[model samples]
Target: MQRLVKIEMSLFKDILSGISGIFSGSPYRIILSAENKKFYLNAYKGAGAIPFAQLLNKYPQLGDLSVWVNYEKGGTVIPLGNLAYVKKELARLISEEQKNKPEIVIPQEIQQLKPSKMPAGFEIRYSWNDSEKAIQPQLRGEYWGEGTYVSENSYWNMPGFTENDDLWLRKNKIRGQEILEFLRAILPQWQRRSLPVQSEVVLEAEPACTIKINRVRIDSVTCEALWRVNPGSIAEIPSLAGYIIAGSSLGEGFNPAGLPLQTESGQALVEEYIPKTIEKVNEFLLQQHHLGMLDMFQPS
Candidate 1:
């Protein structure tokens, strides 16, 4: 790799690349920033392997390379330039992503439950299929409390969702420049054989009414009922609960409840409340969706 970059640099010295650095992360990056001329050259290996790593001493470090773009003094960028040999591309630098592009971690903007986007009663599900290379934004019907369900399907006098299914929220519009900029930044961070992945956000037309069952104290049984909530978002309508969060200090105003430990009493309720609260909360959530979702709750 270094050998090929050195060869490419020497060929363009005092010409294409007046100032150069051999390695800037993987894939040699050469930024030709002139007042008028500006070209970004990204170079890497083609069908070539590092002779040292695999101990392929006799095999060439770099054989055939596809050098493209205007820096090419020889072949075309696509069909023609794809035929250049490593020895042939002394005119242009080579990168690792010759035939295939590198994979990177997906940005948060694209894959998260955007809190800011929630207008009152709508949470966007941003997802992507990397295998198919497609970006699809979905309207997963989720909102904390009640305000106005803003979607194309939502009507002025629509009843509450009753069907046991994913209540698809329609008529939500979204546009974020940060998502694009985040995507562009990851292009350089992409690794040779990895995949990208995202998880939350807020847009102009979105919303969060989730009670994070958090353990506020690590040394004791102290908890914060709901912290990641909007002030006006509680009790208006039953909101969904998130996963249980642990690890905090027994701070001021926190009353550590005393309970019968499993070993200390005939029946244990110490480690039971939070977990049971989670179950009951979620159970109640289902009942709120519609009637007859459950015949009975868990027995005491």
Candidate 2:
């Protein structure tokens, strides 16, 4: 016999209303690293460390707050007041589940600050696998064919670059480091691959904003399956894996100094395996659908 479960909308709304204030508003962007499975809170310029500590105290499951002290660069900071609001909001949302009652209120100070500016020198690198060449150049001058093309002339492409294909490599450059730092805060159990400890800092007057992206190529089969199922959504699939692989490669499994490898044949093998896995997973999902499992989980 199958058991049926129902979720009430009113309860969900009550819970959302309760917790809406807690997670809302920008308190130093909270990023969750999938591989590390840790939540990181970035503190803006001149921000006190106390607010972050209070945030963790309110929601201990978010892991320790790794304070990234930004100065001169001048980014936004989540003040203590905002943190209190977020805590109150989250408490309201969670309390509706018949859980613990909310014991917090939004502090007046948090409501005072203007929204923080976008953090500079930071860009989110998403994955694409259509082209057979590097969309961006590598730091070591090694050419590895990966990534996709975004044309300036095309409505889809980002501006500035010429209307042609760009190369993307998988390596740790400045942009990659930024991404790494962002991921480290979000994912629990996520670790970076070990690299040789360097004694000196390589400072270039014009720091290259490019990030090498030697991401493990997913099996072509998996890519095809993902494409077949989601079609235009293939970009999303690799991105999920990229975050997982990036953090795991850097922090936890650090012996290789590169992204972790799932198979021996490298990209070719991954391209082959992922499609089948996706197919199987998709089939299972379909079966669940037919069995009314989806309906059972749906909120009423």
What lDDT would each prediction earn against the true structure? Answer: 0.28, 0.27
Worst 10 residues of 1 by lDDT: 243-252
In terms of TM-score, the best-performing candidate is: 2
- Show model 2 residue runs off by greater than 4 Å: 1-51, 61-300
Residue 289, model 2, lDDT: 46
Tell me the tens digit of each residue's lDDT in model 2 across 187-253.
1111122111111122222211111223333233211111111112112112222221221122211
Tens digit of per-residue lDDT, candidate 1, span 1-300: 232243335434523332222222233221221111111223323222222212212223323322234434431222211222322343332334343222111112111212232234433344432332223345533221222222222212123332321222221222233333323443223212121212122111112222332333332233233333333222211111221111211111111123222221123234456456435544545634523533322333
Identify the runs in model 1 with alpha carbons over 4 angstroms from their true place.
1-207, 210-233, 236-272, 284-300
Q: Cα RMSD to native, each candidate?
A: 22.6, 25.3
Count of backbone clashes, every candidate in sequence: 29, 69
